[model samples]
Target: MPKIEEAQPKYLQIAHHIRDQILRGDLRPGDEVPSERQLASSWKVSRPTAARSLEALSHQGLVEKRQGSGTYVRSLEVNRRARELYGRAKQTGKIYTPGEYAVITSAGWLEAPDYVAEALGLAVGARAVHRRRVTNNDSGPITLSTSWFGPEVGERAPKLRDPDRIREGTLMYVESVTGRQGSYAEDRMCARSSTDDEAADLDLAPGAAVLIVHHVVYDLQDRPLEFAEATYPPERWAFEQGYPIV
Candidate 1:
């Protein structure tokens, strides 16, 4: 075989080399890649050139650079892929990916905020079951989720008021109690800076941008069942949905 001529930029070439290592399992997620100085020494390149290579990978979201710490491969892509297959995972009552866990940090009746009330079609100041949860893996927090259920549904499903992982998950429990299936969901997506509480919960720096998804779920009768807001660190999660054209 003739030696392949490489035409890509030096930094890109280095990025590709490191990327291959990750793909081949040589450098697993959360594993640190060579430091810029190490790369510069090994590749006989300037430190800036090595830095560019790592920066390129970071931009691709394949790795993350921690302040005062070196770059480490990101678990985001793998986690996202697993989540993408959640429709299949749901059948087994296993909603999360391997090594991941979700906890209901708090659950109780709370006065609905304007936004939550509007989403769930409840009156302002109405009491609603509010459930707060955080999902995480060894890589740290993945998402912080808060769900509100209208009194009609909330009171019916007493389990929703408890602070624990719903063993059968919430949707199934809703179907069981209401004798109705979730017929549709409306989602609104936006990007916003982390709130102080959100920053602390997610281990993100203040003002770091996060992806927010607000969900309104309805039953077959077209009655709103729940309103939920899920906040994700941009690098750790991506949202995807598909539907057939009517």
Candidate 2:
């Protein structure tokens, strides 16, 4: 548990307290956090101040506010690895972090799907190195992704066709062999009802809401290297991004 730092803002103190509880497993998904009234009474702060504290937690994606009920810890955790894979490219050579499972279900050359073609700037019917993978967090399977690498990437790194987890992760291996490091990436995300196959893969009920993420990775030369579509059960994963508004 985090001690309330006297110098820190009151809202930060509260946010840290809640965040620590979640991290330490004291609070589980769907667990109700203390209500603002309870917090105000306990912390001796105004109700507005307590509400602000919860709002801070909401902004951090640690809690969700229900319509009738008070705030609760989110069922999903923010996927820091997903963001760090590209965000820290310049500072670190690492691609994936530990504590996750990656299983390659399929990998081989395949005709690019329409969306993959568009994202990778490949012509329709172009053959690309395709890889299907399932990723699991501590809770369980969280993401199913299909990635397509452009010919430039495939020709440079043939091992991408291997049907196994790349020990150092794809980006790290690609950079080591191709020297085309992922300098940055663009992502689009949306939520929609899961298909039967998707539902089964994610162990969710049919028509349950799922999050989809599309990513395009670019090298330092601004050349497209890979395009991918990743699906996640909303209750198992959360996404976050931070960038300067240039």
Candidate 3:
């Protein structure tokens, strides 16, 4: 079927109407809605407009899009899963380096969050040194990162405490002291939203997006070593992960 007008299509209006019916239980789960031809005839609109309405419903989770098959009703859970999948596909993925630590030192305020405490296995209000630096290729700071460490660790390396030195990068000091004899480290990442402050620090536009990166360095013993987090803007930074072949 032809696409509706790009400039605020009328079919989208029809789509919303059908969507309201679905939400009101007038169209129950597993209940098929009218076919495109039927909808076109009933609405006195083009077949394309009818098709667009169905497509819109498909996008909103009221209908499922199946290849070579007509659309069908989908559950709320299916809609959620579809949204998650779409988000995943949009991600550029995490990019980390081996044998190289990007030293980040930017000032971040300490607001106690339970997860941060749990990650470091430290008590609440325990002082942490967080760094902010951008990890982009000559693109300036693409992702704003605030790598954190307990104050005690930074104290050991007087340089870690210094704003200038820490800004130069302090992972080296952590590696020399608490880290094991490994040249490489492990980094774990998960999707998270950005805060207004984070968006500002990263120099992102309001409502601009970022990828939160959590990097943990471990000794050969597999014990928890150091933990740091970086927030990446999709424009400047991308992550590459390599998994072992089975």
Candidate 4:
């Protein structure tokens, strides 16, 4: 058998093909899209290629993938429900107010990564305090935060560096020192199978859920001051972002 060669990016081809179907009304709004395996067989491509195609479609707002359920074409009639999950991850279980300070501490070993170095204008391998805290809400089990800070600040404010101290707001302290506040927050959310480490952190059952989140808080100057790799348990938290759904 000759190896299947990709004349075009498999996902793009699949997306264009499916899009054509939609445009032609063959795959109407509210239509049930083919499953990954089905798409693979139909296109004679691998499952991964088919999966990517579906994901591309979803990103383009052409389809929606429900957890554990199959993908479906979105209705052009009404918008998909979007909710900005406010952080309830404090013992007080309240929205964070400006000037409120949250203690930072960690559960495991913490070290700054290269990305942090670049963002914070620090030398690579320069010491930075890192912390991972298990944040909780009134309902319980908020997302886990792996936060980092430059050595100057973290050394001066140990509580700000400790992840276990896990208070209500750290952004306040951030503002106080930097003399600035975050103007825009950038989040890159992605759906993925939960790994063992992620499962334990998010308190999820094995192989039973998708983890979604990418939180980047930038200062008024548009410099990335705080970067959080937040992991949410499936169905526990819904992310809200201003994505053009056209």
**Global lDDT of each candidate:** 0.75, 0.75, 0.54, 0.59
Give every collision pair in model 3: 94-239, 94-240, 95-239, 95-240, 103-169, 106-131, 106-132
User: Any runs in candidate 4 off by more than 4 Å, and if so which?
Assistant: 1-109, 118-122, 137-140, 163-168, 237-246
State each model's C-alpha RMSD to the native.
Answer: 11.6, 8.3, 17.5, 14.6
Candidate 2 to truth, TM: 0.65
Query: Cα deviation in Å at residue 238, candidate 4?
Result: 1.6
Which is the better candidate, 2 or 3, if ranked by TM-score? 2
Q: List the residue pairs that clash in candidate 2.
A: none
| lDDT string, candidate 4, 19-43, tens digits | 5454333565678898999889988
| RMSD score of candidate 2 (Å) | 8.3
- Give the TM-score of each candidate: 0.65, 0.65, 0.47, 0.50
Clash tally for model 1: 0
Ranking of models by TM-score: 2, 1, 4, 3
lDDT of 1 by residue, 1-246 (tens): 112225656676787677655543356789999999998888777899899989988977789999998899987443232223224335456556456778788999999999999888888889999989888877788778898898988878888998977766676677789776877787788899999999989899998998888888788889888788888886644534222244
lDDT of 2 at 10: 73
Better of 1 and 3 by TM-score: 1
